[model samples]
Target: MSDRPDDTPAPRDADELNEAVSDLGETDTDRLEAVRGRNESLEERLPGDEQLPRTHGSPEKG
Candidate 1:
């Protein structure tokens, strides 16, 4: 049930660990882009302003 593949081997040294962490961060950008794309698609499907929640004063004022 883990997200990582079972075949992935553990990093044995500090350098290996650093490399692994760097690699994971690089992959995260791709995942983030996919999430943003999905969010935009869902926003497009949402109802009009009348059906959506309303805001009070300027959001920056808070």
Candidate 2:
């Protein structure tokens, strides 16, 4: 029942996450939290439960 394709892959680590985030060109706080929640490495690097409105040198909030 998932909308995602069966062939679609889930992010496995911080590198994968960074790549995905980079491609998006915008920070998705909910998605980042969800991924960080599951990925210890990312969680460790990012830390804190608070949402990150911007990341990876993306544009600032105006």
Candidate 3:
């Protein structure tokens, strides 16, 4: 494991790559409709597509 050299792959990135593609992506509902305008619901107790009722272990003992 000393003077070894067999990796191969010297194909330069065709000039820093950028063939052509620009749409100024933003996604995520355009960043929550441009920050603070909405999109913060984390469902603390209910609301936000509620759905919780699985308990199949051992925690309902009181």
Query: What's the CA error at residue 43 for candidate 1, in Å?
Result: 0.3
lDDT of 3 by residue, 1-62 (tens): 74556785454575433232112224646554544333333334354432655446665656
Q: Relative to the unseen true structure, what is the Cα RMSD of model 1? A: 12.4
lDDT of 2 by residue, 18-57 (tens): 7766743356776677666669776577845356555567
lDDT of 3 at 53: 57
Query: TM-score of every model?
Result: 0.38, 0.22, 0.17
Candidate 1 backbone clash number: 0
Give per-residue CA lDDT, model 1, range 1-62, as digits (tens): 87888889764898775565573346868656766888899999999987866677555544
Report the C-alpha displacement of residue 18, candidate 2, in angstroms: 0.6
User: Which run of 10 residues does model 1 get worst, by summed lDDT?
Assistant: 17-26
Residue 43 of model 1, lDDT score: 90
Note the residue pairs that clash in candidate 3. Answer: none
Q: TM-score for model 2? A: 0.22
Q: What is the lDDT of residue 16 in candidate 2?
A: 77
Say which candidate scores most in TM-score: 1
